[model samples]
Target: MAGVYFYDNQWFEECPKLIGPTDHSFWLGSSVFDGARTFQGLAPDLGLHVARLFKSARSMGLAPKETETEVERLCVEGIRKLPKTTELYIRPMFFARGGFVVPEPESTEFCLSVYDAPLPEFDGIKIRFSAWRRPAQDMALTNAKAGALYPNSSRALREALELGFDNAVVKDANGNIAELATANLWMVKDNVASTPALTGTFLAGVTRYRVACLLRENGIAVEETTLTESDLCNADEI
Candidate 1:
């Protein structure tokens, strides 16, 4: 794909060296990443995504070497390097490059990758209930956007695919509806929209928050409350 990646104060068309075999992040999954989109010369909510990346790095105990302004500049630079007509998934990643025992935050490395990835056409899809359930707060570091949390999600997705479904609706530890395997879950009932309240089981995504705010500002009532799988199956829209 036509794209560029920035690391160690330089940009590359290929991946850069940020980890080694003994790195804590490589062995124990002590890494975090955040993504934003660049399309039509607009990068909506870029600052929020960057801030989240910093917070994720800190929460995961991986020190981020660059400041928020520096990261933003790098993102803009990488996006500018790409073809103007190409839409891209702008990714900023942070991970431990070296450590023994536990990951040392001071050893963190950062990278920004802007690659062409077109937005897909929107069509209706199906969601199957997955056997995997979201972990409770004490079970995993669900508060952070850490890479470790994805394995369970990957299992959910694999299960869904085997069932011939487009995605899976995952449940929280208490057996309440948490979210889709990848995105946040929203249900519409009697023309009113509601999503599961943030209960420490999943990442409360930036897009989900923005969508909720937009709907409320435009006079469509949106609610954040506990949801159940049955609620989704019976809802007017999801």
Candidate 2:
């Protein structure tokens, strides 16, 4: 887990400053985080991830001090300090400082935690249909990758784990399958790949986009359509 953090150009490899108890992010959940990955000395899509981090913060009304270039530079520098053979998760986060209901955007704090973590193999995953569902866009800022939105997924995951499953397939307010507890869901039939359309219920991941493109280029049709629990389970493959 050897990596580093930066606070105003200063690097801290250990014992960095932590969020306070009353911080808006800690108390009111005014925070957003985005992740990128490093493997074999290459940081793929770091720019897009950083850009999305800032976008997520802005969507939640928080101001990020660092630019995408700056964040990417810091990530590259941090990855250098870690073991080259080990995979790493590069997470850049932003949080608000003070407010009652709405956060003070100017009080946003930033941290980039690049830590060594192994990349899981893409063998397969076990999923169960979870009882917990996602909120409607009117009920929450579901479009952004906000911290407060994650606890619901965590609960769904806990329930699935208790049932001896690896992950849970979450539903939306309308009883449509939203996604798995951790990622977007895809099903296959007759060599065609289909996934649930973006409905402001989950983050649109970068890998999903690239994979869809690659599939299309290779002549495997990919469709973004509404999906239900029944549709997924009844599919030829998932």
- Compared with the true structure, what per-residue lDDT tens digits does model 2 show for residues 1-238? 5777766567788848768988889999998988888779898778888888888998899988777788888888888988888789888888998888899988988887888788778787788998899898888888778889999999999999998999999999989988889988889977789998888877788777877888999999999999987788778888
Per-model TM-score on C-alpha atoms: 0.96, 0.94
Model 1 residue 64 lDDT? Answer: 76
Give the Cα error of residue 59 in candidate 2, in Å.
Answer: 1.2
lDDT of every model, 2 decimals: 0.88, 0.85
- Global CA lDDT of candidate 2, please? 0.85
Q: Which clashing pairs does model 2 show?
A: none
The reply for model 2, stretches above 4 Å from the true place, is none
Candidate 1 Cα misplacement greater than 4 A, ranges: none
**What does candidate 1's lDDT look like per residue over 127-186, in tens digits?**
899889999989988888889999999999988888889899899999999999988989
